[model samples]
Target: MIEVRGLTKTFGPTKAVDDLTFTVKPGIVTGFLGPNGAGKSTTMRMILGLDRPTSGTALIDGQAYHDLKQPLRTVGALLDAKWVHPNRSAKAHLQWMAASNGIPSSRVDEVLRLVGLTEVAGKKAGGFSLGMSQRLGLAGALLGDPKVLLFDEPVNGLDPEGIVWIRKFMQRLAAEGRTVLVSSHLLSEMALTAEHLVVIGRGRLISDTTVKEFVDRSSESTVRVRSPQLDALRSVLTSHGLTVREDGHAASAAAALVVLDSTTDAIGQIAGSNGIVLHELASQQGSLEDAFMKLTGDDVQYHAAGVEEVMGGAL
Candidate 1:
């Protein structure tokens, strides 16, 4: 397990991370989420001992990363897939890392195969595409078969196929009882990949909860109803103290109402009791992207107001 207790980091007068605390349990994939410049990278650096924390602790299995005898054997990370030396071949790079960490050279070939990079293992790092670099970085991370893994934007430049592969790979890692923590901006993919979430904004913890709980808490679920007797159904629903609004799709001829804070069964029961002819009644829960926006609206450090207005309405 990975534990971060009151972790804080400061650079000059700016506080990058502030008194943040969370735990990453094993056998599950935990998503670390935040807006741009939200100190996620800084916190990860602190956890790996690449950056000094202003206060508090970041521990892996009750020991600091720096104190580990063979750090790669305990924790593997792909913070920057492009951080490798440009002059070295992919195979040579992993060979050097393994040599330093006392990992067998044979493990390098195994990891290369694991990441599907064996065919290009002889290619220079600088010549690899972003997706190939990401795969190589993953190969290095798996060289030691560590019990814990941290991936930062592992899908940054990946194609759809690569994205699917990485998602399945992370799931497999967690299934093997390894602690997996990932940080990414793709909320939709994160929704499918992560079981738990640790969301932060402006260097502070906003929420640390399961994905289901986070979505349920952040946005109101709405019950959508379409009926020929929309007027009567609306009155009945309103009389029951439920706030109902015409759905956007309910134009001049459309008869649909979206009931807030309601369930499908309750809506159906009310319509049946009132003899309302319902064509459809469905429960629509908010998406993960919607929930993230609602929770971190104010915490976002930057915004293009005009662009957001245009895109938001269009979306």
Candidate 2:
């Protein structure tokens, strides 16, 4: 497990991470989410002992990363896939790391096969594509078979198949009771891969919760109902203290109403009681991306004003 308590980092006059505190437990995949320039990379660097924290502590299994005798065996990380030497082959690179950590050279081939890089093990890492470099980095991370793993943008240059493979691979690692923490900007993939989330913005902790709970808390959830007797249904729903709004694209086929603070079953029961004929009734909740945008709307560091203007003008 990874424990971060009151973690803070600063560069010159700017604060990169601000007293961030969270726990990454074993047996689950925790997504580290933030917009660009949200101090995610800085925080990860501090966690791995690559950067010194201005305050607080980041611990791996109750010990600082530097204090561990065999750091790779305790915690493995892939921060930058392109940070390897250009002259070394994939196999040579892993062999060097294994030697440094006292890991046997025999384990090199195992990790190479595990990451599907066995075919390219003899190839120079500098000549590898971004996807191949990511695979090699993953192989190095797994060489020690550590209990804790951290990956930053693991799918950066991966194809669709590679993305799917990494998703399943991360899940498999978590299933084996390893503590896994991944950071990525791909909200859709993160929604599918992560069970829990730790969201930050402007170097501050915004949220830390499960995916289901996060979505449930979003105010975007509304009950969409369509019926032939639209006026009557709307009146009944409004009289019950429910806010009803017209669907933007009401058609002659049916009138649709969006009911706030209501459920499909409740709306259906009300319609049934009033002898109303309903065409459709369904609950529409905001997606993960929607919730994330809503939560971090004010915290985003950059905005495309032109894009916003164009979208607003179109609307």
Candidate 3:
């Protein structure tokens, strides 16, 4: 397991990470998430001992990263796939890393095969495509066969096939009872890949919970109703104390009413009782993207201008 407590880091006047605390237990994939400039990278750097924390501690199992013997065997990380020497061959790269940690040269070939890079083992790192480079990085991370693994944007340069492969690979690792923590900006993939989430913003801890709970808690579900008399239904719903808004994005010619914090049963009962016609009534559960925006909306450090402002009355 990975544990971080009171983890804080600062660079000059800006605090990159606040007093954050969270645990990543084994046998599960935990997502590390935050908006740009939210200090997620900083925290990960501290966890791997790449950067010294201004205060607090990051531990793998019960020992600090620096204190672990054969550190790579205890924890393996792929923070930057491009960190390898440009002239080094893929096999040469892993060979050196293994040598440093007293790992045998045979393990290098094992991991290269594991990452499907055996064909390119003799090729220079600089000649590999971004996707191939990512594979090489994964090969290195698995060189030690560590119990804990950390990956940052592992799918950045991967194709659709590679993305699916890596996702299943991480899940398989977790199934084998290894601890896996992945940081990525792909919310859709995170929704599918991670079982739990550690979300942060502005260098502060925002949430640490299961994926289902996080989405359910952060976003409100709405019922979408379409009818010829949308306005009339809106009025009835309003009279019943339901918050209703026009669903401008609906496909039908007649507008729909998006009733917040409502259910099909209640809406259907009211519509039936009032003799109102209903064409469609469906529950719209909030997605991971919706919940992420809702919880971190205010915490975002940068805001892009709205379309109106950008267009400036041109239309």
Candidate 4:
């Protein structure tokens, strides 16, 4: 497991990461989340000891990454896939890493196969696509057969197939009892991959929780009520202390009302007594991204317009 206790870092006057503390357990995927420039890259660098912490530490198993006898065998990370040389073959790059860490040369082929990079092992990295580079990076991380893994933007530029493959591979790695932590800006992708989440915003830890608990607690749960007699139901619901509002989006389709109150039971009781025939009365579920936006959006370290539209457009 990776234990980050009060891990902090600063660049000159800027505090990149502030008093962040969380535990990343094995056998599950923990998503590291934040808006752009929220210090995610800096924190990952600190974990790998590429950047020094201003205070506290990030420990792997019980010791810092820099203090390990064989850091690769203890924890492997892909902080930036772009760090690789463009001139070198993928296999050669892994071979170099293996040689540096005293890992067996044969493990190079093993990791390449593990990440499905065997076909391109002989190709130069410069000619490889973003998806291929990501695969190569993942291969390097597994070269040591480490118990811990950290990935920063593992699926940033992947195609649909590549994205799907990476998600399953991360899950499969976690199932094999390895600690896997991946950082991503794709909420929909995270909703599928992560079992737990560590949400960060403006360089501070906002939430650390199980995916289900986080969504259930932070999401705004509202009961949906649809009926042909929307007016009667709305009047009856408002009279019974259940604040009701027209679901304008749902209204044209089925004359629906969305209850603003949390008393589903009371709404049911009132609807039954008022002789209201309910077409639909169910909770409107919210996504993890929706909850995150509700919580950290105001203070989102990075704000970009049309990004959501672009992501939506891709769908």
**RMSD in Å for all candidates:** 2.4, 2.2, 1.3, 3.6
List ranges where model 4 is wrong by over 4 Å. 263-266, 305-315
Which model, 1 or 2, shows the larger TM-score?
1
* Top-lDDT candidate index: 1
lDDT of 3 by residue, 208-263 (tens): 99999999999889999999887788899999999998887976676788999989
Residue 289 of model 1 has an lDDT of 93
Q: How many backbone clashes does candidate 4 have?
A: 0
Q: How close is candidate 4 to the true structure, as a TM-score?
A: 0.92
lDDT of 2 by residue, 161-197 (tens): 9999999999999999999999999999999999999
lDDT on C-alpha atoms for all candidate structures: 0.94, 0.93, 0.93, 0.87
Model 2 worst lDDT run, 10 consecutive residues: 247-256
Candidate 3: residue 89 Cα off by (Å): 0.8
Q: Candidate 2, clashing residue pairs?
A: none
| Worst-scoring 10-residue span by lDDT in model 3 | 246-255
Residue 247 in candidate 3, Cα distance off native in Å:
0.9
Residues 198-262 of candidate 4: C-alpha lDDT, one tens digit per residue: 88877899899998888888887788877778888888877767767778786376777888746
Q: List the residue pairs that clash in candidate 3.
A: none
TM-score of 3: 0.97
Question: On TM-score, who's better, 2 or 3?
Answer: 3
How do these models rank on TM-score, best leading?
Answer: 3, 1, 2, 4
